[model samples]
Target: MDFYLVFTIFIFAGALIGSGLSFYVEYTKLEALESYFSENKVVCDNKRFWGRNTHIDRFYRMLLISQLLAMPKTHIKRGDVTEAELAAIPLSLKRWALWPINFGFIWFASIIIWNVWYR
Candidate 1:
């Protein structure tokens, strides 16, 4: 196969895996995260804004948690997440919430780069 075709296939597989992991986190761990952050007004308000669509709500929640894990200081300064609350979260949960989103972001950027470079 051509190198571009092979690389594109790899990117597609990575994106699929990232999406699946994202879905898994949303289904299994999202509720716990929601409860933990229930008192955070910013998170609650965003959740409420996406309340009309459960899928979007869950996706947003995943993204929020990922952001919270990736940049605790920023969210802390913004009052979106507290340090104590962030410390209380399990490391495994944090990893689960973080990696897939990171992978998705990388995968997206790769696709954009590939298109721009190869087109």
Candidate 2:
């Protein structure tokens, strides 16, 4: 295979692998969070449940602040879950889903530049 083609394929394959791994990590976290909420009987607003942060928040923060984030504002307002409740969450591995995506763009840009500069 041509060198450029080989490199492009490798880049795309890496992106695919990274994306798959990130998705699995995120799915696991979501399941864990949902179970935790159901057990604790915490109710979150629909907006909170479906927000951008809910979908794409980093895994490290997710592990730490998930309990706080899962709680509704009413609970906080009613003094059910305190700001100090926010302090006790454990630390864990950070899920990074964007590495492949960022690299994909870099690869694309490099390919374009290579073509232009070489031709």
lDDT of 1 by residue, 69-89 (tens): 899998888877889888888
Tens digits of per-residue lDDT for model 2, 1-119: 77777766766676677667656656665544434344232334332554454546444434333435544376678754555443333344212323334455676786686677557
Q: Which stretches of candidate 1 lie over 4 Å from their true place?
A: none
The CA-based lDDT of model 2 is what?
0.50
Highest lDDT against the true fold, candidate:
1
Model 1, residue 66: distance off in Å is: 2.0
TM-score of 1: 0.86
lDDT, model 1, position 116:
89
Q: Clashes in model 1: which pairs?
A: none
